[model samples]
Target chain A: AQSVAQPEDQVNVAEGNPLTVKCTYSVSGNPYLFWYVQYPNRGLQFLLKYITGDNLVKGSYGFEAEFNKSQTSFHLKKPSALVSDSALYFCAVRDSVSGTYKYIFGTGTRLKVLA
Target chain B: EAEVAQSPRYKITEKSQAVAFWCDPISGHATLYWYRQILGQGPELLVQFQDESVVDDSQLPKDRFSAERLKGVDSTLKIQPAELGDSAMYLCASSLGLERINEQFFGPGTRLTVL
Candidate 1:
């Protein structure tokens, strides 16, 4: 089974401060991790993904994520938080060895950038 | 850029009523997925289609939920006798293929409210 977890239900950060949303995963084989953001009444937007390259992957809206194989974690990060960045964040994983194409997602974390 | 499209941005219905949602994937995309997102949770996959063929539906509730992609272009998901727990957002996504590396494009979800 492949699963992801976002321990925090919500994260609050001051504007211009660095922010992080934690995510951890479990998979039977190598994992393909991804991050997505969703705004109010809108569909989820792709942020970034880690397949098999560098540990740090850059994404849209000045966001990035670090994939730690030893820790089984892929945490989304931003150098400077913006009010517009406040939204719901989700982490997803696909087990490449599982021979399935489906992705398992975490419960999601709500990010609030305070001005 | 081309994107996935969904219909009925919002729906309200009494318990035991039937409701349906539709999705149109981006041109040439061969994989489509339907997901249900409860409040404060990540989207959960309900069904997946690959070129009009059912690829996965392990998590879908067969008793009340049915999905079909007749022409490999558009798809429909119907829930009969919807329960209160069915109130949530129905999301549709598409990918170029079943490869794990392909990113899925999402459509604006349909918010269903079961009264």
Candidate 2:
């Protein structure tokens, strides 16, 4: 079975400071990882994904994530946090070996950017 | 900027009542998914469809919840005898295909409140 874990329930960072949201996963084979952000009363928007590429992947809204195979982690990051970036972040994973399209998602991490 | 569309942005119903949500995926999308998101949690897959055929529904509560994407382009999910636990945001997503790296596009989700 494949699973994802978001260790933090919430993260607080000052605006203009670097921000990081942690995520880790367990899968039977190579993993396809994704990050999504959901704002209040809105649908989740895709941030970025890591299938088979460079360790660091950049995404929408200046967000990026680094896929660390040794750590089994794909942590979301932003060079400079913005108030607008405050939202719920989710990490999802799909096992390529399973040949199934289902994605397992973590509980989520709430990010708050303080002014 | 084609995106998934969902109906009944908000719904309120008494316990034991039946409620349904609808989704219209982007044109040409071959895969659609239904997910349930409880407060403060990431969305969980309830069902997945590939070209009007159910590809995965293991997480769906078949006893009380049902989903159908008869025409393949649009889908519906129904819950009978709604329980308080069913009150949450129901999200719909669609993707191009079952490719391991395909990105899913999400809809604005329908918030259901069981009273």
Interface RMSD of each: 0.7, 0.8
lDDT of 1 at B11: 98
Report the CAPRI category for model 1: high
TM-score of each: 0.97, 0.97
lDDT (tens digit, per residue) of candidate 2 on A16-90 = 999999999998878889999999998888999998879999999999999999999999999999998989999
Error of 1 at A13 (Å): 0.6
lDDT of 1 by residue, B1-69 (tens): 898999999999999999999999999999999999998889999999999999889999999999999
Q: Which ten residues in a row have the lowest lDDT in candidate 1 chain A?
A: A94-103
User: Which residues of candidate 2, in runs, are more than 4 Å off?
Assistant: none
- In the order shown, the candidates' DockQ scores are 0.85, 0.85
lDDT of 1 by residue, A1-115 (tens): 7889999999999999999999999988678899999999989999999988899999999999999999999999999999999999999986566455888889999999999
Residue B11 error, candidate 1, Å: 0.7
Docking model 2 quality class: high
